[model samples]
Target: MEAFTRLDAKIAPLPLANIDTDQIIPKQFLKGVDRKGLARGLFYDFRFDEQGREVPDFVLNRPEYKGAGVLVAGDNFGCGSSREHAPWALMDFGIRCVISTSFADIFYNNCFQNGLLPVVLKAEEIQQLMDEARGGNHVASIDLAAQTVTSPSGAVFHFDIDPTRKDKMLRGLDAIGETLQAKNDIDLYEMKRALSQPWLEEA
Candidate 1:
């Protein structure tokens, strides 16, 4: 996982509510477990027609948002199945941060684990961000350390995040990375246990 300290990038507007995992990366594209190449599958249905031709009407297909790293979406974003692939797809597509009024429990945590910042702001704040996103090239700066999101016009909004999760993201530590931080302690404990119960180790 990559560190998410601060980001200043153009925002992409995804204003539809209840965007589930299937819509994010349709099941048909779930053939591979690897995270690579999934970006092409992100929002597959919305981005392509039945014949697999690019759909010009999709927000992501628009030229202005082609390289967008921030996404401002509607309420209940990432609802439905608990699929880790959703965040993988988003990250592969260069979305480092997502601002929304609400998000599914699993998806929100998945974002943190995958190095994607899922921000939960008030409805009014989200709407303002959405408006800013609609304005092409209006970039939003997100400071994970400060726990705030700032719009291009100098508007700032504060948000809350668990201190532990914040620290993990700041250090680029995922669950495995966090556990490895105590490697010495773990090794010592295992050594002591082995000495105390040699029979157990043999078993």
Candidate 2:
């Protein structure tokens, strides 16, 4: 996972509540475990029409929102099935942060694990960011270290994040990366166990 220190990029407004995992990537596109190419399937239904043409009105397809790295969304974002692919798809599409008033529990946790920042702010704050995202600039700034999000209009909003999760994201440490941090201790323990029970190692 890539470390998320700060981001100053375009913000795409997705002012819809109760966005489920299926709507995010769709079941048809969940054909592989690999994270690559998942960007093509992110918001597949909303981004493309029945004939597979790009939806002109969609925020992501709009020229101004192209290359957006932050998503200002409505409440109850990422609801429904506990699919890790949702965050993968979002990150693959270049969205590193999602700002909403509320988010599903599973999806919120998944975001941290995948190095995607899920920011929860007051309803009015979210609305403010949403409005700014819709403006011509469509850009925002986020500082993970400072736990702050700055809207395009220069309004700053502070958010709360768990300290452990914050540290992990800053260091780009996923679960495996975190465990590997104690590699020497783990190796020493294994060596001691093997010496104490040689037969166990042979088995």
Candidate 3:
């Protein structure tokens, strides 16, 4: 997982609501467990036509959003199954942050675990960000340290995040990384247990 202290990048607009997990990466692509190749499968149905050619109508297919790292999306985003692949696909697609009015309970937590910042803002705030995303000269800056999202025109918005999760994200610590941080204490505990129960260890 990578640290998400601050990010200043162009925002890609995905205004459709009720975007479920299947629409995100599709069930076909879920056959593979690896996260690296899931980006090709992100919004698979919407990005491709029956002939397997690129669909020019999808927001992500638009040229301006090609390298977008921040996604401004609609409500109820990530609403379906609890697959971890949803965040994986988003991260693989280079979207470090997803801003929506609301998100699914499971998916929201999944984002933090995967080093993706999922912002839940009010509907009005989301609309403003969506408009800024469409502007040619606009850019959004997300500062995790200050917990603020600022627009190019100087508008600012505050967001709330759990401090524990915030600290983990700032340090680039995932579940595995969290466990590894206690390595020395874990080793000492194991040694003490072995000494206390030598017969158990021999058995």
Candidate 4:
């Protein structure tokens, strides 16, 4: 997982509500478990026609929004079944942050683990940002250190994130990286336990 301390990127707007995991990457693309190659399948159904030709109208398919790292989406984003692949696909598709009015609990948690920032703002705030994102000249700035999102129209809004998750993201620490950070203490504990109970160690 990558760190997300601060990001200033073009925010592509996807203003549809109830965007479930299935609509994100689709089940047909779930055949592979690795996260790296999932970007090609992201929004497969919406991005392509039955003949696999690119759809011209989807926000992601538009030339102006290409390479956007931030997403301003509608309410109930990431809803439906709990599949970790949703965030995985998003990250692989170059989306480091998502701003929405609401999100599903499981998907929200998954975003934190995958180092994606899921910002939940009020409905009005979303509409405001949505308008800014629609413009071709706008870029959004998200500062995780300050818990602030600055829209292109010069409006600033505060968002809440778990302190632990924020800290982990700042340090670029995944669960494995976090555990390795306490490697010294773990090594000492193992050594002491082995000496204290040699029979258990052998068993």
Best-matching candidate per lDDT: 2
The deviation in Å at residue 86 for candidate 1 is 0.5
Candidate 4 Cα outliers beyond 4 Å, as residue runs: none
Q: How many backbone clashes does candidate 2 have?
A: 0
What TM-score fits each model? 0.95, 0.98, 0.95, 0.95
> Tens digit of lDDT per residue, candidate 4, span 16-100?
9999999987888888779998998888998999999999999899988999899999989999989888999999999999999
lDDT of each: 0.92, 0.93, 0.90, 0.90
Instruction: State which candidate, 2 or 4, has the greater lDDT.
Output: 2
What lDDT does candidate 4 reach at residue 82? 90
lDDT of 2 by residue, 1-203 (tens): 89999999999889999999999989987889999889999999899999999999999999999999999898899999998999999999999999999999999999999999999999999898888887777878999999999999999999999999999999999999999999999999999999999899987
Better of 1 and 3 by lDDT: 1
> Model 3: what TM-score?
0.95
Candidate 1's TM-score: 0.95
